[model samples]
Structures are given as C-alpha cells and as structure tokens.
Target: MSVAVDCSSEETADILVESQNSSLLENETEDIEEFFNVAMELAKNAGKVVRSAFSEKKNINTKLTGQDLVTETDQAVEKMLISSLKERFPTHSFIGEESVSAGKKCELTDNPTWIIDPIDGTNNFVHGNPCIAISIGLAVKKELLIGIVYNPIQERLYSAKKGQGAYCNNEEVTVSGQTELENALIYSEFGAHRDPEKLEIKFGNMYNIIMNGHGIRAQGSAALDMCGIACGEADAYVEYGIHVWDIAAGILIACEAGGIIMDPDTGGKVDLMSRRILCASSRSLANQLKNQVTPQSFPSD
Candidate 1:
C-alpha cells in the first residue's frame, strides 16, 4: 500500500488552475484524469503490498460472521493506502473496508472521496487463489470520476475515468457482446449474509443461472469479477450484500466498458451502496438475470 506518486502540490495547483476553465464538462474531465493518476499510483502500491503478503503467514480473524474473514494483510495494506493517500490529498475523504471493520462508519458525501478495498478478495488470497485485486475509486461531487482495479497476482490492471474508455493492461477493453443469458458466462460473489430465506433465494438464482447460462463462476472478489465483465472475460455478474467500497471501482469500469449495472427491483438506478447488484455485459442480459433472481419474487423484499 506504499505506492509512490511523486506529484507535488504545485502540480495539483496547476490542475486546479486548468479546471477553472470556461467549459465545466472539460474541467470535470481534467479533474477525473488528475485523480485517476493518483488512484492508479495508490492501486499499484497496494498491489505490491498484497503480492508481498500473499506467501507470508497472515493473522486471520472473522468479522460479523465466521464466513467473513479478515487478515492482517488487509489491515496493514489499508492503513498504508489511507496514510499514503492522505499525504497526497489531505482533504479528500476516505472510506476503506478495514476502517469500517474497525468500528468506524463510512458515509459518502458530495466531496472528493476515495473508496478503497485494499485486498478485494481476502478469502481467495487466504486460500492461495490469484483472483484478488486492489480496488480504488475516486468520487467527486457524488459522481464517480475514476476507477482502478489491479490484480497483482495476475498482473492485470483495469481502470477507467468518467467519459473515458476502460482499459486492461493498458489495452482498451469492453464487455462481452453476448446478449443472451443462455450464451453468457456469469459470476456471483455471495457475501457472508446467510439468512435462511436469503440463502434459498440465492440458491434459486444459482440454479436458474446454472441451467440457462453457458457457465457460472463463484469468485470471492467482487472487484475482479467486475473486471472480468469489463474485459469481456465474463458476460454477467450478480451478487448481494456487497458494499460501496466493494463495487465502486468495478461499477465505473463496467459501465465504461459498455456493461450494465442494473437494479433488479425497479429496473432503474443502481446505487453504489445498495448491497445488491446485477451486472451484465449488456442491458438485455442484465434485465434477463434480474427477472430470474430478484428478491421480490422470492420470500424477502
């Protein structure tokens, strides 16, 4: 989490000076690029921390539920990330998973904020899997301006700025063109919420997807799953009990890659902190997945 960005205050001042131009949209774009550069720097540093910790003996513990585990690497990486970012952008708000797990509440406002998941797939990392990533996102004025998801183990980096195209390993990427659920590859990250009724609904959704979709992947990392969809590696993703820091970066990356982040309930807006998500390579596939697994059709609302 000690990624280095040699940007000085003078550069930031220059960016501010440029952002005060006549066109608001252009100014916003410049701001997004500026913050995106910072986020990418932090993400790369976090990736280094994660990779270094992968083979070491980590102190693991549970949170909220036994299924929800946290490692010392998670804590250390988050601390390093927040401290590094604070050194660069002292006024920016930070909402990190480790901080929230340590009893701090995270509330997003219309200010420049950084939402970070130091090690997105802690379980996978614990289990010696390489599907983990460092997720970092910047939101300005309540709008997501930059998204960065870096899988250090796989050496894959996915990033996007608002109104800019998404990229994977420096190459532009897009969502899969598959529009039908029957021909799509779907991924789901089941959180630690294991209520009986919810489990029933989740299993039902899995069954339907298994029967209809070409394949289904159960990954422990929501950010990497979203990157999969962004690069057309996976056609869709559906998960519940996810938090803002979990999918904030992924949402921007997916949307920029032509994927759809849909609300199963109203088929309208998808809130970043909604705790529910159904993403697809296309709107049609997203709607189709929503029809199959929306909670309203089951016991819970």
Candidate 2:
C-alpha cells in the first residue's frame, strides 16, 4: 500500500543527503575491492623477491648508523614495488623507506599514496630470522584504508580493507581480548639504536612494560608485531623511532581485527609520521599501557 504523504523540505533534504552518502560508500567500496586485488598481487610478487633472496648472502650496508642496515634485496624489492605499482597507478604517490633513504622527500599529501617498506625487518632478514615482512599501506586523502603485510619467509599474509575486517592467509582473525595490563603480552623492539639517550628512553619504557605486563618479546619487526596483535597471538605492541611504513599496514589490520592503536605518549590518534605507536587488544588495555609507558620522540618520517 502506497501512502500519498507530503514530505517537508528538511525531510527531503535528509533523504538526499542519505542517498548521496550511500552512493559514496558504494563507490569507495568498489575502489577498495579493485585496489585490494591489485595490492594482493603486488604483495605476493614482492614476497617472491624477498623469498628468493632469503638464504643468499646479501650486499648489506649500514644507514645512518651501523645498527640500521639495508641490503641489496631491500633496494631491489623497493624498486620492483614502485615500478609495478607505478605502471598500474601512475598518478599515485609513494613513500618508500629505501626511496626516502636515497634522498626522496618523506611527504604525505591528500593524494592516494602507497607507503612501502619492502623489508620491514631488514636486520632480521639479514640474520635469516624469518620475522621480516613486505609491508604496503594505502592512504587516500591522508586516511589509511588499505593494508597488506606479507611475511614471505613465514608465508603469513595479513591484510585489510577499511570496514571489511582483517585477515591472515585468507582466514579472518581477531585480537586476543585480554584487557588487563597484568595479563598482556607486550612486544617492544627498540634497543638497537646506538644513541644512548634514545636507548635509555626506549629501555625505560620496556622496563615499565616488563614490570607491569605478563611478559615481553622483541619481534624486531613492527609490522609483524601488529599482525600478532590482530591474530590474537599477542596482546600489545609499542614502538618508538618507527616510521610510517613500519606500522601503517599493520595498523589497519590490527584495528580491523578488534585491536586499538594510539600514540603511546598521548593516547590519541597516532600521527603516522610521528615515529611512535602503541597497539593493544582493547581500548581499556591500550589506555592502561599508555598510562604506564614512558613517552619518547623521534624526527618525523
């Protein structure tokens, strides 16, 4: 039965706005699907590059300090990722760790950008530690909407598209719902820096976690650490002196898997370029960690 009712102008306007919002959501979903499929392929291809070079001795070089290492595989994989993605998305922007190290500006704009960290755990990769990852994250209009982190050595692929939840190797996964600080397992990888001042701050934060939390482990790979939170293997992760590429992909996957992320210092929305991060299984747990952890800073990426 149809009712012949007169609608107010405000009601009509609300309907129009709702319709527009629905249309926008649908379009964004379509774009996400297209982008996700392409991203999946790129991650797999990048994985192949990493996998092929895993056991081979690499030409490793130190960056900034003797502790910060970069290998030939890192450069090759970065180039491969940029080239392939550029071929498919010429207009897209990029922020790659290797590229930035090579003199490119580490800038983020409103344009669609691909943040790539070809070998997130380069030190681990060099040590044949199987804890490395090919991390790719997409930010459009300065908001992260897609993330892909592939550990070719471990064959663990974690991914997410905004609103669709997170996955590991095609299986949906979630965070361990341990909200208490005493019960949480924490991941902190920050003692490698030679700067004694930074090391002191990093270690102090670690000390707090150790005293308060159930236990701690240093994964050496921030991307995988966040994925560990997403897959319920870990309860929390915190890092200072990490760049955008290190946590961008992992942030989305972890959040989609019912985890929470924030600035360890402020407990606010994390500034992707700020080089600080805290990820936890729940808001209560994250807030608890934020309260205990010592704050530290680094130059933005």
Candidate 3:
C-alpha cells in the first residue's frame, strides 16, 4: 500500500518564511560577533596607551572646567581608536568624548555607531588612581549591542553582548540581588559640574542614599561603578551630569548582568543623552533609589 501526503501551499510558504528569518538571525549574530572581537582588541590596545602614561607626569588640559581634566593620553588613545575603527568600519558612525568636546556633533542615527570614552576616569587617571576604564560600546538604531570596559591597571575586563549575560575576566557575573535600599551598597558621584547650586542638589541626593543604604561609595568613575553593580560589588548606582560615553558600555554590562536601569527623575526608560542614570540589582531597589533621588537640571548631552 502506498501512502500519500499533501502539504498545503500556505504551509510551504510559512516554512520558507521561517527559514529566511533564521538565516537573517544567523547573519546578525555573525556580524555582531565580528564587531565584538574588533572592539575587544581595540579596548586592550587603548589600555596599553593608558598603562604607559599611568606613571608618567601627564600633560593635562581642562575641558569645560578646571576639574574636568583631559590628558594627552586621553587624546592619543581616542585618536588611535577612531583611526583604527574607521578603517575597519568606514560606514559606521562614531561618537568619542574628546572628539565631541572638540566640536564634533553628537548625533545617533540608525546606522551602527561606536560610542567611546578613551579614558573614563580622567581625573582619577590624572591623580594616579587606578579606577579608570577604557570604555567602548556599539549601538545600532540606539539599541546597544556590545559593551567592553577594560580597567587595565586593575586587570579587570567587563564585557557583554546583546541577549548574552555579562562577564568579568571571562567569568559570568550578576547583580547582588538586594531589593531593599537598606541592604544595598550604593555607588554615586558628584559629577564634574561644580556649580554651587548643582552641588547643593547633588549633596542632597547623596545624603538621601547615605541615610538609606548600607553604604555609599564614590569611585569617581561611572563606568567602574556600573561594573561594580554587575559584579555584585555594589547594588545601586545613580548619577547625573555624566555623558553618554561615560555610561554607554557600563549600562549594557550592568543590564546584562541581571540589573535594571531607569531614569532617576521620572523612573521611566533611560534616555542616554539625558545625562542622568539610576541602576540597581533589582527593580524594587531601582524604584526605591529612584524615589530617593532628587535630580538637578542640566542641558542634554
């Protein structure tokens, strides 16, 4: 006896569609993997520049204010990264802190763009502090895809890929899993803006955290602070007046490590250019921190 099987035309079309979708997904994965490898290598090379200048007396320059310092190492590293990345990805967009400060427009289009801070903790780097990071993040249509922050001095490397868990030194990491504010180890900074009025508001926010949390720590480096959240060293991090480059990589790494990010003001979705951030190990903690924060006004970055 012969058995006959009939397949409907619609079923065939559906199968074809599924296959096409799978192919597209595979291509996207491969593309991102390539981008990630390039980014990681660039971060290591940038670290070399930072390490070389760590012990040397540096040529320091002020950007917006005297406290907002930028060293020659910062410029050299940024130039090296931009030059190398442009060669590899000529069509992609770029936003570097030094470049933007030098008047390059900070625009995020739908194109793949690399957001970079050659040296995240410039003040710390200037003062011989090792809490600095070479931060690099890639975004497509404002969707973060990869984040890599390497603190060469401390030999700590934090990284993440979209939909993939965060890692520190090749080992997966996670948030501290503390929902209550009292149990949270909070990280914050006064930021580079020292306007007396702004400082007054910032201090008020700090006081709130100091009174409510287990402890408040100030690292002067937003990237490293966020990494602390990822690796369970800190439970919450809130800051205002930080540029997108400062937290671009850190944000993804923290979120990938089972963290939550929100706007400190409205507690809504984060706006990267808003110059504000609040992140925690859990949504409950994030909401608590959000309520405790009193944000100051600053022009969008």
Tell me, by lDDT, which candidate is best. 3
The runs of at least 3 residues in candidate 3 whose Cα sits more than 4 Å from the true structure, single-residue gaps closed, are 1-26
Candidate 1 Cα RMSD (Å): 8.0
> Which stretches of model 1 miss by more than 4 angstroms?
1-25, 296-301
lDDT of 1 by residue, 86-194 (tens): 9988889989999988988787776788999988888889888998989998876556668899999999999987657789989999888678999988998667766
Q: Would you list the clashing residue pairs of candidate 2?
A: none
TM-score of 2: 0.91
What's the true lDDT of residue 13 in model 2? Answer: 26
lDDT of 3 by residue, 1-301 (tens): 0000101222222212211222323457888999999999999988988998999999999989889999999999999998999999999999999999999999876688899999999999999999999999987756677899999999999999866789999999998889899988999997788799989888998899989989899998999999999999999999989989998899889877877777788776677888888878887898899888887778887
lDDT for each of the candidates? 0.78, 0.83, 0.84
Candidate order by lDDT, decreasing, is 3, 2, 1
Return whichever of 1 and 2 wins on lDDT.
2
Model 3, C-alpha of 87: deviation from truth (Å): 0.1
Q: For model 2, how does the per-residue alpha-carbon lDDT over 208-287 read when each residue is reduced to its tens digit? A: 88899999999899999999999999999988889888988998888778777777887665778888888888778889
